[model samples]
Target chain A: MFEGVPLTWFLIVATIMFFIGIYGFLVRKNLITILMSLELILNSVNINFVAFNKLLYPQHMEGMFFTVFVIAVAAAEASVAIAIIINIYRRLINIDVERIDEMKY
Target chain B: MLIMRHELLLVIITVILLLVEIFLPDNRKHTIILPSILLFFIVTVLGFIPGPTGELFGGMYATTPLILTMKNILNLGVLIIFIQSVNWLKKIENKGKIGEYYLILLSTLIGMDYMISSGDFLMFYLGLELATIPLATLAAWERFKEKSAEAGVKLIFTSALSSGILLYGISMIYGTTGSVYFREVMGAFNATPLQVLAFIFFFAGMAFKIAIVPFHLWIADVYEGSPINITSYLSVISKGAAVFILMIILYTVFYKIALLWRDVLYVTSILTMTIGNLFAIRQRNIKRFLAFSSIAQAGFILLGLIGQSQLGMTTVIYFVLVYIFSNLGAFGVAGIISNVTGKESIDDYDGLYRTNPLLSLTMMLALFSLAGIPPVAGFFGKFFLFTAAAQKGLYLLVIIGVLNTIISLYYYLLVVKAMFLNTSDQPIAYFRSDAYSRIGLLMCVAGIVIIGFASPVYEFILSLSHGLY
Candidate 1:
């Protein structure tokens, strides 16, 4: 079941995007950037779901439905994350992950 | 309707709480507490009623005797938390937001209920998000507190990240199998390289929720920063729900790769148990102490899972039931003390027995239960888990589990020693916990004392788990 754009290409791009997300998550100092990285990770997964559905299994709509649910859930998660970020900014006057360690062992 | 009775009733109660809050005046915000607990208590009791059990919504939602029992266990734990939190919620600092707290908590419970009953990964994803996102708000409930806000940020960030990984794994599973339904996926699953990678991602995401070793860093801070009641909810109810779902999925959907996952569990279990025990040893803050101990408990739960049969499922569920009682008892005493005295350190607990003998006795029983000492429910829980693992002939893992149990006993005894043996000039002053909290603690104590000697409870779980594998 070959197509104009191969499934391997899509998988490669998603993998790259996913790893970039992992990198940003580990390296980012600011909370909003980390949040963005999370979105990147999720969006990459959405790409994988969509491509896998269209390319590998066109007869099934489950992956498409899953992608839609994921997008909706990711939005909700982003709103909650931003609320938390704004709250952290209000309380600590910054959203730097390094400076937020008040309860370390 | 019959299948989702638990979630439906919980949602209705949340709406009732919300409407009641709007009608009630400001000074009487505390009144919502009683109604919330009463309504939730009714829901908990009603959950045990025999009901229709089968597939729903094109097999997206399902329930069985085992799933009903799991939901009932979660309901019972949340009800106790509602009762235990009454005093904290009544504080002036919490003021008008009391209704929102119950609503958010109820939503999370609903999420968990759906997650537990999910027949398809789509429903599971929705329930997982519903269960998780509100909890971030709860972690940062005290938005003005720096640590609380930090905890919220960390929790949301990590949970979002983990869910993303989990979804990616689900995408792969869907790609390979062309279905997200558990039954369909299980039939098509294989030990292919990509499927193995997908399983690992799925396991890691779940490990984050369960607070296994690699993903447990966020737990201590979150537990300490959140309100004491939220902390207990996270550790007991939230963790229990995740464990139940993970066990179900592993035993069913991933049964094709049991050997692969068992090896993974064997390594992670040892790391989780040893690391959790070691970190728990030096914690000064009681919340952090319990945080690490609960992580260790999660590790022990893995031993039961590694057994990989009907007996494994039985022990894991049984242990979780016992754990909820034991851990909640410990946190109830700690919460009451913290709420009344604002002293949260081990040092502050010195000479506690002199002033408050009953609280001290409760703490001692809780600690003993945690240490898996004979006569309490935790010992029986651990004993059964060990027996299940040994039945599978995982003798070396059992030995390490036993060793970790010893290490855990020492730390638990340290708290016991502080409360009963250590002396200090300025001990916490005696104060009576509210009647509601006393009732909650009493329930926990009763559960801990009674569950061990009750063979019928084990038999019931075993019977329910008979066809799980």
Candidate 2:
């Protein structure tokens, strides 16, 4: 049982982490850093899932399964993101998010 | 008896395409496109075959009439893409690496197939990721172009962000209902704040996929930078898949909570359309202009969600059917002109009809359909959507929709004016299309023209849309 840590605390921490990721996403100028921010956001969701699974449906283990899937997807997404960033770097020789504004309207 | 007929078909075709590439002689590698197209053409026909429809894999995958028809429609879209892409795909620059294109394209189609047929949250999430990750690579398929790579990065990053938000919402829903299966959650959910919040987050994620107004920042840039073939794929098939699944979840799982989200949709619909039109007017790049126009079209499609009745479903299906042809025809013309002349701006299209009469005329018909002109497929589609909304007594939405149509008309006609009336010193010269591309263009033209006059497609769509309620 989660004797000491309340459910609200877990929810609050996860929410905070999610927003932290968003803040990082907004402020970071490097593609790699922005991707890292995205990872943070996904991880926060995983935390919420795991916590809720433990709190509610401990018998089914649904949330834990979702967490594992999220982890796998995040890995796949990160790899793809890194590949694209590298592709950009190869062409432009810079990975700054600001410089990636070439096609913006 | 695997029961996943459509997904299996997609996979078998993907494997065959990939396998064919390995054995192909270096000089004849591009010939793989022919087999791939032929195979897709077969699948499009096979899609019409009746198959058993029910949940398989312990309720993870479900096939219904709606999903079957949607899958077939998507197959048709992919088939058209193969036709439109062949000549451009076989150019010398695309020589050896052609297999990679079809492989990813087929993989994305498979993902979308599963997404449409998915019966639970786990499958939905998996299918969505499968559909999304390959697209970034496809957007950046022209690796040498800086803009292509940029588009890929933006696409992946934004999709990742949206997926995370969506998962958080899913977690909330799981917490509230203790399940992710549609059937189970539908019974348990009662519009709790947590569940409502979950739906909101989930909607926002899909809205990003559809490139709705607030989350539409990446669309113009992505469309501009991506290869024209992939741009058409994104505008039509990808969007159609998302809309198909979005309506499914909304009408089935979220129906009980409709009152709460209806207002949310109303505000976003108006904002999405107005902003799409306003931004579309100023776009110089034809691809970016279409991007905004598609965004506006997304807003119009959202009107279908307002009613959640069979007529609403009918309108959504019909409109999407028309859009797949209309948008692709326009992009195909743009692709043809740009492939020949390397022109991306509207100014480059001035007096295009003087030389390339076929391309210009097809472009006019497509644009006219998109503007919802009478006697085109698009008009009936929009008419039914408006009728659906009006039946629900949402007259304000219909009125706003009418005004947005006029706003959209101005820009769509601008292209027509530039193509027909405006004259340039040097016009784009007439070009002969390959037989396949001609067939593809003719197919779209046929859809734009013939579908309006024919009631069979409409009736078929209505039959498929049945049983949702």
lDDT of 1: 0.91
- Model 1 chain A TM-score equals 0.94
- For residue A50, give model 2's deviation from the true position in Å: 1.1
- Runs of candidate 1 with Cα error greater than 4 angstroms are A1-3
lDDT of 2 by residue, A33-55 (tens): 99999999999999899998887
Which stretches of model 2 miss by more than 4 angstroms? Answer: A1-4
Shift of residue B319 alpha carbon in model 2, Å: 0.4
Weakest lDDT window of 10 consecutive positions for candidate 2 chain B:
B1-10
Q: Highest DockQ, which number?
A: 2
Write candidate 2's Cα lDDT for B1-469 as tens digits: 5468888888898888888888888998877878888888887787788878889878888888888888888888888888998878877788888999999999989999999888889899999999999999999889788888988888898888888888888889998999988888888989988788899999888888988879999888888889999999999999999999999988888889888878888888999999999899998889999999999999999987786788899889889999999998999888877776789899989999899899999999999999999989889888889999999999999999999999999999999999999999988877887787888899999989998889899888887787655
Q: Give the Cα-based TM-score of candidate 2 against the true structure.
A: 0.98
- Separate DockQ for every predicted complex: 0.87, 0.89
Fnat of every candidate, listed in order: 0.94, 0.94
Judging by lDDT against the true structure, name the best candidate. Answer: 1
